[model samples]
Target: MTNHWAHPTAIIDEGASIGEGTKVWHFSHISPKTIIGEQCSLGQNVYVASNVTIGNSVKIQNNVSVYEGVILEDFVFCGPSMVFTNVRTPRSAFPRNTSEDYRPTVVKRGASIGANATVVCGVTIGEWAFVAAGAVVNRDVPAYSLVAGVPAKGMGWVCECGSTLTFRDQKSVCHDCDREYERNQDIVRKTKDV
Candidate 1:
């Protein structure tokens, strides 16, 4: 028997790769050749395409569809109803027939996308970034950045521990985790003892 758990109602197509301790809830469908790493959670009604790659310890909430050309790294969180689009300009009359036309999207490690957010393809969401609910991201997000609003804008920065950062003199420190950061123009990087 496979080590992972799948609901009796879930449909896991043959050749789909599910890692140990992963769980697929009711009414979900995992397509063949999709690789889901260990300890991930696939909620109800989720649809995973064969070309997608999901890393370890990921949590996907209910009603999420992980389409082709999307890669989610370890510890990423996909909130309920959030989506990743494969085509930037889609039309029913001009359907994209080949994978080459699909723009790939990468959600880096430890990022959290809120419910109802839409990540446009060809963009990279950096590590530990947070996308608030209802935001539409069209560009690359820097690490620890907090992006919101339609056509998402970087409004603030967040700590890896999930706290809003307060900057002083272009430097911010996470009170919760005691992590320090230095801001340069629009980018922020963690300070290391060098």
Candidate 2:
């Protein structure tokens, strides 16, 4: 038997793969073909669809539905009621033939998606990117970027420590952690410590 712990009300299919130390709370549904890594937490009413892949130490908050064709890497945080859509143009009359018809959405390592945010399909959220609450992300987000507002334009940079960055002459120093970053146009990457 798997070492993962789930509440009695949770429905975990026999074909699902849950790693050791993972905790799935009440009313969650883990579908077949899904693989969740170690130390992950699925809060109440969460739904992980078939074939979804989640890496280690991920935190999915309450009422979130992780649809098919989505991959979440290690250290990712998905906030409450966040939305993920697989189809770009979903029509009720013309149903999708299979899960392969769905577009892939990837949230990279150390990324955090805030509550009620919407991640559109086929978009790659770079490592350490932060999506603010209620934002609508329709495009790719760069690493160490902080995006907010409608359509989720890159507002500024964010440190790996999860603090907002202030740049001077395309060079930013994270006051909270003293990590340095170089910004070229819209792309930001950690360079060193200040």
TM-scores, all candidates, are 0.95, 0.97
Tens-digit per-residue lDDT, 37-84, candidate 1: 999999999999988999999999999999999999999999999988
Off by over 4 Å in 1: 192-194
RMSD of each: 1.8, 1.2
Report the lDDT tens digits of candidate 2 across residue range 1-194. Answer: 77999999999998999999999999999999999999999999999999899999999999999999999999999999999999999999999858879999999999999999999999999999999999999999999889998999988889988999999999988888899999899888889955
In candidate 2, where is summed lDDT lowest over 10 consecutive residues? 185-194
lDDT for predicted candidate 1 compared with the true structure: 0.94
